[model samples]
Target: MSRRCELTGKAVLTGNLVSHSNRKTRRRFLPNLVNVTLTSDALQRSVKLRVSANALKSVDHRGGLDAFLIKASVDDLSPKAAELKRAVQKATASTAAAA
Candidate 1:
């Protein structure tokens, strides 16, 4: 797998490392990705994802995985996260329709 965050689409960023002598070297600024199991209240299941630290914090701030996915924009999310967002939307819609 690539060094990418599944939720936020965060990946390795290329930049220059400058020294005191004015010399520059190529360097990578990688996202802080971690494997986590998040439970979705809408789906009533646990899902595993490789997400960046910021994304995890956002999920918490949004209340849960389903809430985060529902509020997140598709352009800023990875393919997997987009799919999960769709699933969450569908589940919530079904629940609402049934109620």
Candidate 2:
């Protein structure tokens, strides 16, 4: 409903536009949001969401938006899955000594 990304929690940011001449003006930085159908486990139907472009990129990078939503909707399993996945990733890192 709002002009915000539901998936990534991105919202419009208000600030001052500063010029080279030290002049400032009011401006707004809007989030890049798109209305999309996200698979919903709770409703057992595809739900619409306002998701940011970056979040969409994350989805795109890791297969697709559907895959990202499925991963997000899975409860109880996600945390453990994320932890294990991170651990495996960390172990595989070439710069382990640097870390």
lDDT of each: 0.91, 0.59
Give the count of colliding residue pairs in each prediction: 0, 0
**Model 2, position 45: C-alpha lDDT score:** 46
The residue pairs that clash in candidate 2, if any, are none
Best by TM-score: 1
Report how far residue 28 has shifted in candidate 1, in Å: 0.6
Cα lDDT tens digits, model 1, 11-97, are 999999999999999999999999999999998999999999999998999899998899888997888889989999999999999
Candidate 2 deviant stretches above 4 angstroms: 39-45, 64-99
lDDT of 2 by residue, 16-55 (tens): 9999998999999998888776553323345555678888
RMSD per model, one decimal: 1.0, 11.0
Q: What is the lDDT of residue 27 in candidate 1?
A: 96
